[model samples]
Target: MKIFKKSDIILIFAVLFVAGIIFAISSLEKGPPVAHIIVGGEEYKAVNLVDIPEKQVFILETHPETIIVCEKGCAYFSSAGCPDKICVKTGRLTKKGDTAVCLPAGVVLTIEGGEYDAVTY
Candidate 1:
């Protein structure tokens, strides 16, 4: 049996258009500049990616040091002691609230005050 009528379809379209507008407006807004580094599930450090004029790297104190690279308002795993190197492959995180993790090394990097957070749905 047909469930949606003509008016129902138009209403759905209108709702979707409004939602699209809201999403776009929110996406265009800026977010916090801070980035946080966690090692062994603990708060390790916080940094402002925007403040660094040049590229920087850090070695986390893990079983083997975890190397992280910060550049151009983004951070990524340039290299890691983890055997799989999966974290290194996670790629760049530029937007606020972006995250990269190395479970084997107990390391996590997340952008603070990101524009959007993970939604359960």
Candidate 2:
């Protein structure tokens, strides 16, 4: 028995072609890297990662206390007040669309504006 029939192969190729086109368009629209800090569901600050002159740390207004650090072209949660500390474990947010969230503190740090190649399972 044939593994992939003629129609099946054609459909697979067509899907890949459309995916490539969408990826290309999305890549072309990317901008410079930026990090946005949100507190209590509101945007607290937006930092241009590419324009950072030096490493910086910020303490947000949250219970338990949360800290974020940014340098060069990346940002990350250095510390979090939540017991889980999952946000701190998230490491660096170097790529666009990367996010670190501390649920208890109501804080989120996300990277915005940059090219993302692909996400693999």
Candidate 3:
């Protein structure tokens, strides 16, 4: 008896073809890179990271204050009043889809646009 069947091979090829199409469309939709800040599950602010004349810092006065710093083509959580400070440890976010979150303060910073890339845990 054969372990592989013709129908199974055709199904796999069809699935791969659809996945490739979806990936191509998604990649073509990206635009200039920008950083969006969300606080308390709401959009708080957005910063264009494509062109920065100088380093800029933003302070969010939440339950526990948080700080964001942006330089040319990169942004990061520089400080957080949270006890763990995990957000600050996330380091600079220079590529599309990068993110940093401070759970205690309900603050999230994410980079969007430029180009599409594979996601990682």
Q: List the residue pairs that clash in candidate 3.
A: none
True-vs-predicted CA distance for residue 56, candidate 2, Å: 1.4
Q: State the lDDT at 55 in candidate 1.
A: 83
Pairs with steric clashes in candidate 2: none
Task: At residue 43, give the lDDT of candidate 2.
Answer: 92
TM-score winner between candidates 1 and 2: 2
Question: Compared with the true structure, what per-residue lDDT tens digits does model 2 show for residues 1-121?
Answer: 8998999999999999999997666546577788999999889999988768999899987997999999987899998878999999999988777889999999989987874453355
- TM-score per candidate, in order? 0.66, 0.72, 0.70
Query: What is the C-alpha local distance difference test score of each model?
Result: 0.78, 0.87, 0.85
The better candidate by TM-score, 2 or 3, is 2
Q: Each candidate: how many clashes?
A: 0, 0, 0
For model 2, give the RMSD to the true fold: 7.6
Residue range 1-121, candidate 3, lDDT tens digits: 7877999899999999999997666546577678889999999888887667898899999879999998878899999899999999999997676889999999999987865343345
Tell me the spans in candidate 2 whose CA falls farther than 4 Å from its real position. 1-28, 116-121
Ranking under lDDT, best-scoring first?
2, 3, 1
Q: Ten-residue segment with the worst summed lDDT in candidate 3?
A: 112-121
After TM-score superposition, the amount by which residue 93's alpha carbon in candidate 1 deviates from its true location, in angstroms, is: 0.6
Best by TM-score: 2
